[model samples]
Target: MLSRARLIQRLVIFAIFSFLLFVGSQRIPLRSNTVPSAPSAPSPARDSSYERQVQFWKNLHNLLESNSPATDPPERLKKAENVLFDPNANYTRPDLFAISEGDVKQLQQVHQRVVQKIKNDNSSLELVYHRGKRGIVSAAGRKYLPTLVISLRLLRRSGTRFPVEVFIASQEQYDEVVCEQILPTMNAVCIVLSGILGTNVVSRLEPFQLKSFAMLFSSFEQLLWLDASCFPIHDAIEIFQSKPFTHVGLVTWPDFWSSDPSRFFNTIASKPEPPVSERASTDGGQLLISKKTHAKTLLLASYYNYYGETHFYLLLSQSDVGGSDKETYLAAASVLDEPFYAVNEPIRSIGHRNANGHLDSSATVQYSPTEDYKLTNQGINHVKDANAGPIPHAFFLRTSYSKMSPVNLFDPSRNGSEEVSPIRGPDGKPSRAWTAEKETIDSLGGPDVEREYWSHVRWTVCTLEGLQFKDWKDKEGTCQQAKEYFDAVFAPKDRR
Candidate 1:
């Protein structure tokens, strides 16, 4: 997690970079000499005419699909030019990213290796990248990777599953992120959704458009959206529950949007009066979205988050933009009244509707009864480290729970073990661990060194003095205890 002040500063910087890129993309000449590098067995991204034009001319280009092997391909712009120019576009809105020094190199090397793997391969299932997504987000010079790309990269690198049919407003940024890091991790590819940011009202958005775009991609009803940040924490399946989308579900909480109105988009949203119904809570971060089945609600939610700029500013003014994706999503839900079923206890559903046309939110549209879910629940810990998404199912959906799996770390005792042991390798001297362990005190969300103790301690134990992992098997060291340790190390003078 990042502090408000530091996140604000970095976002300001990245926003500048994105703005420059956006401007450059629209204004620069698409020189024919500029070619997007294509690797063998490519995913057809760079090979597409739209990509060709984008690479050569930093100008706005449309992606055109071809039916014939030979002859002139028809030029079709997937995203509208006017949409990009709309100051009201949702891309500028708030969302979410950084860290330390010696830890920077390890992250970079991991990132570079991923990038190289993608660049060298031409599989239709290659990973995606964005050109602008370079440099370490955790530490200076260390590149922070797009969670989606990194997630996919980890999946493919481990040979989990593939033929990822994702939706891209345009594959430009996708290719860019992939090219930078997390290339070899792509398996197969299929993108069948919008490629650009929707016509979201801009004034009310979070001011960080790229995050909006990324989240929109997450909402594309494609990726399983495994929770991760910069590094691949462990081995897990990308679990492309790609079966068709059956219905949309929301975690019903009692009075979440107590005082707000604004259903979703400002163009057409009412502020929350006093809330309604018995249930109204939603994870709003992790989601299992799909366009094929009955998930129009998800689409509707996307529109709210990516609508014309009018609603963007409206939403931002009322909300903190701190929860980043989660915050925006909840605000939209409060305003949109999109149909979502409540999942109180866990594992309550499993399949698609048999003779259903579309889903009726009133009746329980379930794959199975909620009583059957038996996945181990590391509830407190997992929920704490849970990735931001619409629903929280993926936390331990199919995977076994380990204490360290963010969601499972709530109990200090079950801090779970590291997947890869940080052993003193062949070179003797405790092998240097690749990590993001150190950062300037200013950046770690701390005014004083001790305030950032948790991050520091975790950083120290995970990587410093040779990478030591939290061993759940041993069932030792509680988080509270760790805090005590942190206080001792950083601020011993004022202990109570």
Candidate 2:
């Protein structure tokens, strides 16, 4: 219809118009067919949760910094300050720290109430233990309950006035059963914990959380925690009366393997320098805490427990040997610049009785001649020898050579009716029980003594269940040579 130049111009215009339409179509999202993109910003609930977590940690930091004791050394204060202010610090996991707005408010309220309670009751001291259920019906838990009962019985016998509190982490029905049946007999108060903190972590980490944040469940100003395995043979009240415990708020003992601090320190990523003192070894089985003196220490310990495995990957590894909690406690104490009193004299916590009648106790026990054996700066006597006084506060009785069945100790149906007794022979005679007269008679040279000694030695035979003890016939290479084999499997990578 038009000339050649006009036709060309018209076609070019149409092409440009089509291109413009295409660009417009691309810019405008299709409402019917297009999949909606996620919002760029976090939802209001998520935003609120994150802010609360941030605020929670910030408040905790402030609390630690402000409430730290005046006596705290400059190094410890500085460490606390650095950890609190560090922008990169993984203080808490957002999900675990605050599950919802309700959780956030509840945590704050509980924390405040606990703090207030501790402040109001400065003179009160309480003994607390934690028991976490292993299964719907826990066999190990049943064993532990009797152990706790024995310790409480000993404590009551020793005239301890402090109330015993048991923290049970189990189903509501199980808790009720324990409360109604077991706690009633023991005269102990039972508190059921929700155990929400660090629940996502491995099973072993649960102990760290339970022990580190023990104050959350405790209202007392001073708290003493005893492991279920520990048996208080004497009045533990004497321990609190001791100068070491009174002077220093936190007190612990050395581990059996207490050679190197570097082995433990290396397990922590921060790699805090161990204390210069000889008493740097950690035994967390027994701990005495003073709320006012060790509040910051407690917080630091809890923080380490929460973030320890993350910082030190070795803690999460198989070769850790369940020492991560102990390592974290020691590291936190060191960082806090707090003095943790380690009794110089061995506390006869773990005792082994051999067939020879000579007690292979922890290095701390000694023979005493006095009727009222005084507890000196040296550790308490665990073994009661001839002409020896009572062992003061002998906590642990380790019968590792012969494993006693839990069935012998606890009956869940009967609620632990079995009375505690010494290891007995087939003839019903106490195997390990020794009398001064018998020892004297043995020393006087008699054929009867020889027979009796041999009889005692025969009882030392290993009776540990599950593992078969086979004597190696090939005497050329001792099984002790397998130390390296075990070290490779169980030892930490750094140690190995």
Candidate 3:
């Protein structure tokens, strides 16, 4: 009924409307039965490196576990012993066990005498220092001798009635200079284990093992095992009389700085659970063992050493210092579950060295005339802090100090002064001088009445012994200074 043009116009409008409707439908999203995708997970923050490290440690731990001596104790022990003591081995010493029947009879006589002495003095204490064949031949032996001399001299100076025994791996480790010249001079007994324990037993044990187990061979009731590096500054007999040593029959100072039992636990391959209440980790440098009372403890410590020897590589892997002896003792104490007294009081008896091997300054404390007496009760006077306090009764000069001559430490003429001013006085008066003369009799006297107290003695010993080493020398010309200082301080007035 419509005109043809109009009908065509209507068709065009209809087609346009249809196209608009289809676009609207496409834009409107339709609801579906399917769930919507989770908001794309924030690309998991990458931790590939951490994950890799975790995996690596896991693998390493597994490898160590597989090789543990627990798998086959007997075979491992035999193998380790053979490797350690084979006479054909370059490291083996045949002299360790070489002794004649006459020598045996003589050793027996000596043992009987020692036993008789022990019987007469049940409360007698003996100071023990052990040196292995290798240690004696190396620069370590040279360095240690001076410390031994210093320790024995200090003991004698302290008027300690107890005798000292210097135990050597063999007659070869015993230098005539030490046995004849040094020990006789100090009145110390030199016992060669080659005759006592025989080579088979002695050769398989490491120097540290010999040190820890020295109590087993001691005829005395109590043994104070001091590392060759340890120098007693105070009356060590005081330690024996202390409540911890007297009550527990075992006493050791904690690590100089750290108290984290977990850190100690990590150092042993066995990873024994730490003591529930044991906060401070023990130091082996100074240990007092009562042989009769803590017989079980000594046996336990020896057992740990045996296990450590069997798994030496694994234990070594866990060490930061390449020494596992301390960790082994710690592990033994943990497994024993018996409480041992730890001198948590700040004894400052241990001297720590910097990476450069010099004494750490911050670790040293300044002496206050009034405060020092109080501090001394806490064992603060044990180290001679430069410009701080007088020399302590005992100090642990890190083995690194052995690498350099002590004479290189300071210039006596340039650094020394006659009257050392106290950093602080009772009333905080600047005029008061810190008189070393007051403590000189207690301390090893030095060049001046001031800074040259025990440090001069330490330098003198080190310089004298260091003269033997090829690398360590008095390059600083401090040896002449030491001699002058010694003349002024220690030499008899007539001799000077």
lDDT (0 to 1) per candidate:
0.30, 0.38, 0.41
Question: Model 1, stretches more than 4 Å misplaced?
Answer: 1-142, 146-160, 163-181, 188-221, 226-245, 249-285, 293-303, 307-338, 342-496
Model 2 compared with the native: what TM-score? 0.47
Which is the winner by TM-score between candidate 2 and candidate 3? 3
lDDT of 1 by residue, 351-406 (tens): 11112322111001111112212211223221223342223232221111121232
Candidate 2: count the clashes: 0
Q: How does candidate 3 fare on TM-score?
A: 0.48
Q: Give the CA lDDT, 0 to 100, for residue 494 in model 1.
A: 68
TM-score of each: 0.34, 0.47, 0.48
RMSD of each: 24.9, 25.3, 30.2
On residues 423-474, what C-alpha lDDT tens digit does candidate 3 reach at each position? 2123322211223233332232322322333443455455455444332343
Q: Give the top-scoring candidate (lDDT).
A: 3
Task: Identify the runs in model 2 with alpha carbons over 4 angstroms from their true place.
Answer: 1-143, 195-204, 263-272, 275-277, 307-320, 349-405, 408-430, 433-496
List model 2 lDDT by residue over 1-496, tens digit each.
7999999999999999999999988895433322111110111122323334334434543443343222211111111111111212234211101023453344334334434443444223222212220100001132255334444554555455566656544322122333444445545654333332222322444545455544433435666676544433344555665556567766666543332333223322234443233332445556666655676566656554554443321222112333355655545556556776654333232223444545433212211112112443333432223223333323433222123322231122222321222233224333332222333223223234223322322221111111222221222222222233233333456995
State how far residue 447 of model 1 sits from its true place (Å): 31
